[model samples]
Target: MQILSRPYGALHYRLDGPEGTPVVLMANSLGTDLRLWDAVLPLLPRGLRYLRYDKQGHGLSDLGQADRIADHAADAEALIEAVATGPVVMVGLSIGGLIAQHLAAGRPDLVRALVLSNTAARLGTPDSWQARIDAVEQRGMASIADAVMERWFAAPFRATPALALWRNMLARTPAAGYVAACRALAEADHRQATAALRLPAMVIAGDADGASPADLVRATADLIPGATFHLIPGAGHLPCVETPAAHAALMTPFLERHAR
Candidate 1:
């Protein structure tokens, strides 16, 4: 792991492959660390630069109080400027996707391409999301981690060792940090910004993803002119975890097509 100091706080990240190669910046969803990409990383073709980072208050990154998605995007920009060379292909999941949308729209020069997975342009926390946030805040992530796990993985995945590992990780997340992220999700609105993005983009969603259903994902793709949309069957919110090979297959073509 590498550490870089930014104005907001210290950022934790990992770099892989050659430095001069085209860069792909991978960002995790809310409550997840950079390790969330562990399965997908090995499937990616070598010889390309890759940057994976834990968002503020997750994993080894600083646990600061960030309430807005813009603040998160700024942090991501700081990390990109510090580590990557020129524009990058930004791949983000869930809340990470929201950050990517904000950054791609707000700072077009910094992004070469975008891949959003299991995310929506306007992921407004429904009544259930708010209730879950409140529950986590009051009783800690452990209290609701199981329920969240059920939503994240498919029925068959629940019986796998990976599921247990993921549940453990989610259960251990800091309540404060989790709640802060929830607040960010609760207040985010990327619909307008995503509609304005002209850069090469793709949207991938799990067919069984309840958080961001297929229709919503398709709607997001439609909002972005000429963006490609792919769906991974039998997977839920976390496709990288449930179906890493499919995730890589969908992403490889998009990245290769847009490679600089």
Candidate 2:
């Protein structure tokens, strides 16, 4: 783990593989830290550089004034610019996908390719997200950890030890930061921005994902004009956890093909 100071606060990140090799920066889903990529990390080709970081308020990253997805994207851009060089393959999931879209649209020079997984161009989150943010602000992160976890993973994942670990992480998250992230998701609108991105892109979705359905993923892929779409079976939102091998197989080629 390494700490890099940004304009808002310190950002926590892990860098792997060779420094001079092609860089891959991974942004994780909401409510999940960089640990969410643990299962898929080892599957990546070792010759390339990789960076995984906890968004503000998640994992070991600092809690900054983040109340919108743009703020998150700015922080991410700052981190990438501070650490990696030009033209990185940015891989993002869930809310991270929105951030990636924002980055690619706003700062195309830094992004060479994109992998958006289990996410949408625009998150049509119902009022439930706002309600949850209010609940967290009023009560605490613990107040909604269970409910959030239920929505994060599928039924089978909830029965595993990994679920317990995830729950613990949620419980430990600062309520203020969690609420901030919730508010960010509530205000984010990536539809227009993502539609305009012309980078080499891949959209990976889980057939069983309720959050970002397959049809939505297909629509997003269609909008990207020649973007590749891969749907993994027996997986929900977190395909890297539910079907790591399949997820890795699909991503390995895409990343390698686009690597500079």
Q: Of the candidates shown, which would achieve the greatest lDDT relative to the real structure? A: 1
Looking at model 1, how many pairs of residues clash? 0
The whole-model C-alpha lDDT of candidate 1 against the native structure comes to 0.86
Among all candidates shown, the one with the greatest TM-score: 1
Q: What is the lDDT of residue 164 in candidate 1?
A: 79
TM-score, prediction 2: 0.94
Colliding residue pairs in candidate 1: none
Candidate 1's displacement at residue 73, Å, is 0.5
Candidate 2: stretches off by over 4 Å: none
lDDT of 1 by residue, 2-28 (tens): 998876678889999886888898989
Candidate 1 Cα deviation (angstroms), residue 89: 0.3
